[model samples]
Target: MALPVGIFALFVLMVLPIPPLLLDIFFVLNIAISVAVLMVALNARQPLDFSSFPSVLLFATLLRLALNVASTRIVLVNGHEGGNAAGEIIESFGQFLVGGNFAVGLFVFCILLIINMIVITKGAGRVSEVSARFVLDALPGKQMAIDADIAAGLITADEARTRRREVTIEADFYGSMDGASKFVKGDAIAALLILGVNIIAGFALGMISHGLSAGEAGELYITLAVGDALVAQVPALLLSIAAAAIVTRVADARDLSGQIGGQFADPRGWLPVALILAAIGMVPAMPQLIFFPAAAIAGALWWTLRQRAARPAPVEQPVEEVSPDRIDIADVSDQTLVTVELGYGLVHLVDKDKGAPLLTRITGIRKQLSRDLGFVLPQFRIRDSLDVGANEYRVLLGGLAIAHGTAKPSRLLAIDTGEVRPGHGLTGEATRDPSFDCPALWIDPAARDHAVSEGFLTVDPSTVIATHANQELLRNSDQLLGPEEVRALVDDLKERAPALIEAIHPDPLGLAALTRIFRALIADGIALAHPQPLLTSLALALQKTQDFDSVIDAVRADMGARLIARICEPGERLKVVTLDAALEGAILGGMVDPGTGQPLIEPDCGSMIAERVNRHIDEAKGPVALIVQPPARRALAALLRQRASRCLVLSINELPARQPVEVVGVIGADNPAHQLPAPTEEVQAA
Candidate 1:
């Protein structure tokens, strides 16, 4: 309401004749407002801190122009009387301030106009135009950076919102400054025109009406005109300087004075100036008194600066050591089911304040894996490590590093999805995709479009780290499903089917044995997406046998069809590599220590079987299983676990009867030369 009323009153000032006392008060108010604006501009740490400066500058310019009209009215109307026509503020400028010389006042007014119009206003306008253009051009890149930080989990939603608001305000301030500069330029021109009118019109009217001569009228009226212009121009000059200061302000945490003093604090900077001044002082033609004293002052400043520079820095206090009794055992523990350790540089990837998306992404990964695996994944702990290199992160499982890699937040990784040839396209730091080790290039963000067009998949550093963590979580799924998770699963299942759990547990299969079976199934790359079939098979298997291995085998056979379908391409015939008749007979005959539950096979025969199966697996494009008789499945699986962990051993009874089977390779028969001598012959001789 105050601003609106003030603006309206400024408009009224142009129409109604202002009293001399009110005019002086208004003149002082204008000076005070301009000074306040200049002070605010100087103290503003960032341009956005004073976002309303352009509007204030506009209002100040209007008010000054309005005062010009009122002062002009009083000057032309009453200058025929004397120099004290307008008010004391005007009279002081006309007499005491300018030594009662209208010529000196006129010269001063012209100089102020030139400085404001040619120097401050013009320079500020150009800076505003350039700043607005550059800020607008960089807006998209800045927005992307913010979004990338958010995705990386560097900043929280609230912080991102605040930062985005600041960016908008900054752009708006510059754009407004660009337009508001015109007001100052126009005001300078108006001041010139008003000065002309007050002098010429006052002289003409005074000579014709008051019977005064041209010289008397000119002397009297011109003084009033110069006084009015100077008073208005003084505030105008301050406001112009304020505008220039704001437009040129760089974004920083320190105010203009602090920034300037900080930058100029170096002793080395003053030493050169001192030397130049001393050299000039020694010249014969120069004023020895003035130059020598100025040189001496500069030299003294340089010497003082050197003394400050030579002073030793204060030593930091050492950190106090904590007593052993005060240490918490949990704080020193390294036992976490899953942990993500980031280096100092990559810490922004988990900082909610900066908008890093890694934490959120890890949560999503855990949720998806937990849902797919039929058990809730344990909460993964994240911490920053100074021991690791910047941009490097380690994915730890049970306090051990499972996967680690380096990523650059400011750059994008363009992975070649077999679309672009390796070492082709844009030049960059050649690297591998951390998750899959696929060939990739770390390129600048500006080259993302080019990389995409050239058939490369571009991703930021946060995505790369998240992907690596996700892969590690999947690969270590078996270890993640511990006793606690199993107990949790039982508790959840009890809510829906309490009778089913009561039927088999404690009496036949204890919780520990059941957990082992689940772990084994997961280790074999089987998703527990549907738990009913596996649970039903476990219950039925417990009725027949108490052996956990036998129960696991039974569950696998029961879930074979679904698991097989999941592994193979839709509608494609199952392709598997099988052992020869002799190898199967020998393996069955060599099985020993049945009471001990250890199906031991001859090492030579086991190695030969593994070598052949691994070769076939390596050649296959998709997943292929090893088909054997039902009795040999568990023993052979255990024997080949270390050598060929990827080889899936499926019993003939487990799969559909009369199932279409394409024998791609006969494991032992295809390489007859690789077969070992019979264990029976060596044993009989011994």
Candidate 2:
């Protein structure tokens, strides 16, 4: 309210009767002050002092001083006596200065300057020190440790499991980031205050001007300068802390990382935008009427465009006519992996800028395989593949690693819809199609020779079948059989026997497929009982029909423990996972990745371990008790606290060997066991 009226009064003074010399002197003082500040800041190696801003003030002051001086000198020399005509008019505009009015204005400006200096001097040094300290830390991960301890006969496995889950929950609600949530509170408050103050000041000035009947509004020019300079400082501090907090939290979240937050969470970007904008707004007479709001509108539009671009398509395109073939048991070969490049069936050539998904058909194939199979399937790990730009995934039921065979690859495809087309296939470095040169295998060689000699089958040297038929034929043969019958039969298989080795478990593809199926079953809460019976049946069937040992190994892993237990029934292994209640709070809260610090993985499992451990280990006392209250209301405080000398670590390998020892937490907890808070979701997961 006072600003617009004040500007008018100042304008009036510029034309009032007074000494021209004093008005010029005041202007000169302002120029000298800005320059002095700049020179000092430069000498101190401080950032340049408001380079553009002080220039604005400097130019205004100098221009006004020059005009006043030019009029004074011209009138004095060009006119009669010592009195100059033009200088007289300039003199009339300076009447306010003859009184105490100018002195008061100068005093007010000086007071404000002192306050600014006090704030800067007090804040700059501390901020620098804090900034340096944050620069030297790393992100967080201790879940592996917690898991190990559980396996090591220290803490209870169930407790460890609970803590890991807690960690995830806490991160979901509060963010795995260090200070993000806390900083938001402060930022929101400060931003609101700034917005409120500016709006009120602008409106109040408008009303005062309306009352004055000058069709003029309050002078917000100076108010804007002061408000911006003052209000901007709030975010400068708030956001700096926020950035630091995010860096800390995320650093703690990641592991196998060089440092936490590496580059992703750095505050270098956000803080500057706000401060820079505030500064531009503070320029005196900069005519903010056009650019300021326009920049805001432009930024919003750009962000909206980018977001629209990033969102993925709602669903995969519908599968239409391609080929008509029902791939059967013989199609998938043993000890072989095949990947077909599903042609960019939808669009032969990708339109880089215009198309959605923006990836080649091969990428789409991988996505499908990943979706149908599992993200971390063993089959993917072991098998080799190449996309032929054909819209299909085919299986090789019979193929050798280094031998050539005559067989066709087949896949089930919809023949009715003809949108997607198939192209020739490529393998390794060579292109292959219906007549490709690739190695393959069939029935067990031992059984094959016996059958041929016994005159049990017709001769077709080029054909090979799955091994199970050969095994049964040999077993029923009157020709002699031995204790190592299966092994001898396998050794006799000549088609690709030289390249075959017993696989203990499913390869990456097999693993992924199984996992995907398992996940799907779980999604609908399907039953999951002991794997032994199911594995045994699959193993026996495959062994009898295909002579494949993939299922055999699967069953072996499932029942190996039981068989081992029966053999050594007196001594059984210990628990699976565990944790210590005492070391709840001592684990580090926030650190960045050692490599590319991003917040620990999406739901940093380790950070939760750190949180839980820290909480368990209180400040004053040596140990505390952990408690889990019923009806867990929130993820934040789910576990109860307990006190002890050290958390009891246990051994998962030998159940009888459970041991006690502290893992992570403060050395001595000050609070009572009951006072300890529950573990955060992230902590439980860790």
Best by TM-score: 1
Off by over 4 Å in 1: 321-686
Task: Report the lDDT tens digits of candidate 1 across residue range 1-686.
Answer: 99999989998999999888999999999999999999999999988888999889989998999999999998888877787778889999988888989999999889889999999999999999999999888776666666555544457657878888878887787889999999999999999999999988988888998889988987888888889999999999999999999999987989999999888878787778878877887889887788778877777877887898899999889889888779787888855578788889888777655654776677678778888898877667778888688889998898888989999978999998788855556868999998877988999999998898888999988889879988877767888888887887777778877777776665566778778888998876676676656677778888888776677777777778776775675556676888898878887777677585555778898888888888877777555678898778877877776688667788886775434556668866855323223235445466
Worst-scoring 10-residue span by lDDT in model 2: 628-637
The CA lDDT of each predicted structure is 0.82, 0.32
Local distance difference test, candidate 1: 0.82
TM-score for each prediction? 0.54, 0.18
**C-alpha RMSD of candidate 2:** 31.6
Instruction: Give the Cα error of residue 684 in candidate 1, in Å.
Output: 82
What are the C-alpha RMSDs, in order, of all predicted structures?
13.9, 31.6
